[model samples]
Target: MDVDFLLNKGKTIGLEGLEVYMVETELLNLTISSDKVREVSSSKTFSIGVRGYIDKRVAGVTINDENLRVDAAFEKLSSLIKTSVEDPNWAGFPPPRKGFINVICRDNRIIHTDYAETMKTIKDLMEIMKDEAIREGAERAIVAEGMTRLGVQKITTANSEGVHVQDECTVFSTFMVLKTVTGKGESDKSFWIMNRRFDLAELESLGRDTARLSLMFGGGRKIENGEYDLILMPQAAVGIIASTLIPAFSALNILEGRSPLRGKLESKVLAEEVGVSDNPELPLEIGSRRFDDEGMPTSSKVLIKDGVLKQVLHNYYTSSRMKLENVGNGFRRNPSSPTTPYPTNFFVHPGEVKLEDLQREVKKALIVYETIGQWMSNPFNGNVKATATHALLVENGEVKGPAKGVLVTGNIYEWLGNKLNGLGRETFTSEGIVAPGVWVEKVKVATE
Candidate 1:
């Protein structure tokens, strides 16, 4: 595709500024069902997105055209711009910037791996799950379904402002849901693992854990409704924090008065032991990137430090609208979509509190492994209400039994502030949220 041609054409057509974003992706996929290989396939896609500004009226168009239909895209964009209302705060597209930090976003191995290798990985993972289930005395367990994906994407951003940048990244991820039957009942659990690099050993470990947990959650019984101290595993902790607290740190939400964290910068919003950051420069993580979609350089920054709200995330639009410096957090789900503020890789800093020691110290806490309905959490008012689908009762520093159908509800501010207990010494990342196990005191738990 000729980006220069698009920019020159837009100028001749009376457009003040123009931007072109292109993505080319190649993906290899393998799906499993009922412990059998359901499908194997490969695909390649080319997408083009164009955004233009005409006298303070901006419009964009996105198309999956491998042939590069410049004329059609421009016609649609022109029509949309003419029908759109002019924005008083409209600014031109961002110019090119330098000093982009180096981040490990690509893995050559994933790109080179073939279909046979991916299928072998799936088979190995299933065998590991079976072995783990047998060791856990639940040999009746079987893999209900799963998928493995290896993909590489090439992203190019070019605009009339003389900004042209390109990036390439690779991703390998897999997930499996295991189901088991026991004398009491049937239970199922799922495990997901993703990274820039592919490693079968690591996937095997996750598979084993999934199998063990599925068995543990079998024959679950309800606990009494009352206040109990809680210990959240890394997955559960990430789920709650990502849904309840992370969105509130976006400058877009703050400016629009849709965030509870508005006007709280530099304030002590969480416990002193709590800290959070957005570190896109971290190596081998799937979200690691050196530049955002707008060709802005990316860097690691602290959002919360020593319990104080240190920095808020910003994209170019939000920061410019608020008259604040752009921190390079701006991203778009697609090229034609408006830029929004989002963390590349959000992390809750780990602490020195060991999980075993913390569990022993809080002997009667409920250990929550996974949750559902977290997306229903309200970020504007900081209200969190989610059901703990996989949890266990712990007493005297030992697992008592499975506790299911537990409804955990609370306000985010209260849970991370006064009710906070401690954070585990180790950290894990799932779906771009890197966090340690989180503990809170006297949390309200409801059951039927």
Candidate 2:
């Protein structure tokens, strides 16, 4: 679609501050189950999202129908904007930025990847899982489920405020679940790897590690309910930490009185050892982007430094309303949705202690590997209650055995603030959050 034509058409129709965002995506997907290929599919999608100021009120519309005419879509959008309700806090779009940091967000190999290559990758991964399962003494190792997705997306934004930017990115993601039946019992574990670049070696390691964890899942025992030291794996830690902190960092949530950090800027809210930031320039990360949906330049923003609340994320609307700098966190699920501040490549800085060293310091603890129902927990109050699907009991700085059907419950704010014990030196990235294993001093754990 011609973005300039859309903008000019809106202007000619008496629209003010018109903007256009177009996204074109090509995607390929494969799924496998029980060591057999189940499905293979590919698709292409084009969507145009338009926003304009009508009578000083902000309104927007999205056009996704491939057969629909662009001119007719523009006319419909103009009519809707004319009757849209007025927003008292409506501000014009951002002015053109001078420079944007060049981010390595695309991988040529991924973009050019074909269906044959994708199938080969999945088969290789399945073979790796089988070998790992045999090494772990499982009677049989089956790929219970596996999925591979590859996509390339092109984003273009043009606005009457003299903002015009276009960028393209490639994404590769894979997930595998290995089920092993040993003489002791049967267990299953899953692993996920995603990035802008494809690395089969990393996926191999993920499979091996997941299989090893599953092999250690039998011979469980119930534990008494009491306060004990807890070590959260990177994936587990991200699930709990991100769910609790992401909401609090949103300027929109703060404005709505739904955030604990609403008025706590510059205050120490976390432990002195903790620091957090939103880094969109991280090399080859899936979340890296040069600009936001609103054509605002993206950059690394430190939201917390040495336990103090440093900054809250903002889009143009929140930044203008609150008289603050826009850190380029503006995001929209699609063109039809309103833009809001959201994290891009959010991370918690790793500490000096290694994972082995941190575990050695724990006298009595539970090393939680996976949890269920973490998203249902409340973030505003920092409350979390999750069931550990795979956990290990640590006694006297030694891993005793697996502890299943256990409940790990705690308050995120308290654990990260005062009860924080240590952090692992090695970091892991999953689901857009990069973090290391975290240890907390006191948490309640019991068998279900």
Candidate 3:
């Protein structure tokens, strides 16, 4: 952790320029309930973050391992920049730069896994969710809950402009919660998968597709509100465009005016069959990163091409206060957060139609597959409400079954402009963007 002697000990404690971020973690957790495998855990952590600047006033600090000494993180970044407040767009940190794109975000067999090989892959994912909830007949199914997590991280960065850097990654996620019953009653469903590698046949096809979609919500109903044509699924279209159109491509929400793509960059604004990108060299996606959180690097951009409005998202202090060109997406939602303009891997471009040929050109749709208050969406005016805790109603194009709670509501510029309709060419990345399954048209649902 000698980030070059903690940036030369913050210039012998006077603090003019310094930065040193570090994180080290290793974790493993497993849980499942009432139907067994109740718990197993492990963890290791250490954190240290510090930023300093004197006259220009910037400050930051985070410490653990009992104030991981470096003079107690530069005396708490010199008493928080002595009552901070003086950044008229202070530009002092970022310096080192290089191509850094080599991706494949770690997964050496989950760092040589164990715990009896992840408890025999969670008892073969609960015997493949009890043989697919007894071939979907379910007169009482189980796997009532689940969880599995494995993590590893290393990250480090230095500063005072010589800008050092380091990185390491690994993540594997899983979640389930099947539960079913017959006589037309109980049902519960939940499924999850996250990556960076680890696949026991895709975690037993995510416990046999969450016991066949929780027995197709056994006799579900309730659907009657208004304008339809929805479809969504790629986890509800990456959870309503990553919570309402990716924070309007934050360049600090377009320089504080809370973005609506403020001043609309290259114009257009969504739907020439929509396209988007941010790609940190794709590969084993988990928001692959090379250098950010201050040390720069990381590239690949094109925030929307056919729908124009190309590029928006920066980092080093919003590209040094909007002077542009810092595509590294700064990021830092912890380690004493600070740097911000996010998005490292964010694609959306996919189409060759197929999700039953885009739900056979919709004739009354709904599909959505799970959502809940999509973060009470509203990226400043690109409104969108959520709550379709699992849907599926389509009519002419088939599947007239499940529906629950519903609600939806829209407006990301009229659902990506003029009710955009068509997207699925099979893509998936969940909770970190990489989408597919979209189609829009009408929208505005509701129910009882």
Task: Name the best candidate (by TM-score).
Answer: 1
Poorest 10 consecutive residues by lDDT, candidate 1: 63-72
Which candidate, 1 or 3, has the higher TM-score? Answer: 1
In model 3, pairs of residues that clash are none
Task: Please provide, for model 1 over 5-90, each residue's C-alpha lDDT reduced to its tens digit, 9 standing for 90 to 100.
Answer: 87897888788899888888899989999998899999999887889988889999986755467778788889999999998877
After superposition, the stretches of candidate 2 with alpha carbons farther than 4 Å from their true spots are 219-221
Candidate 3 lDDT trough over 10 residues, lowest sum: 65-74
Task: Give the better candidate number (1 or 2) by lDDT.
Answer: 1
- Which pairs, if any, clash in model 2? none
lDDT of the candidates, in the order given: 0.85, 0.84, 0.81
Report the lDDT tens digits of candidate 3 across residue range 1-448: 6678877888998887888888888878888886788788898888978888888888888877766666766787788899888977888788888888787888888889988898887877787887788777888787777888887888888889788888888887877787788777888788776767776887777678778877877777998899998878676778778888888898988888998889988899988888898988776667787877887888888888889887898888878787866658887887766888878888988977787665666789888777878889888888999888778898778888888788888887787788877678887785457888877888889885
Ranking by TM-score: 1, 2, 3
Q: Return the top candidate by lDDT.
A: 1
Q: Weakest 10 consecutive residues, lDDT, candidate 2?
A: 65-74
Report the number of clashing residue pairs per model: 0, 0, 0
What lDDT score is found at residue 30 in candidate 1?
91
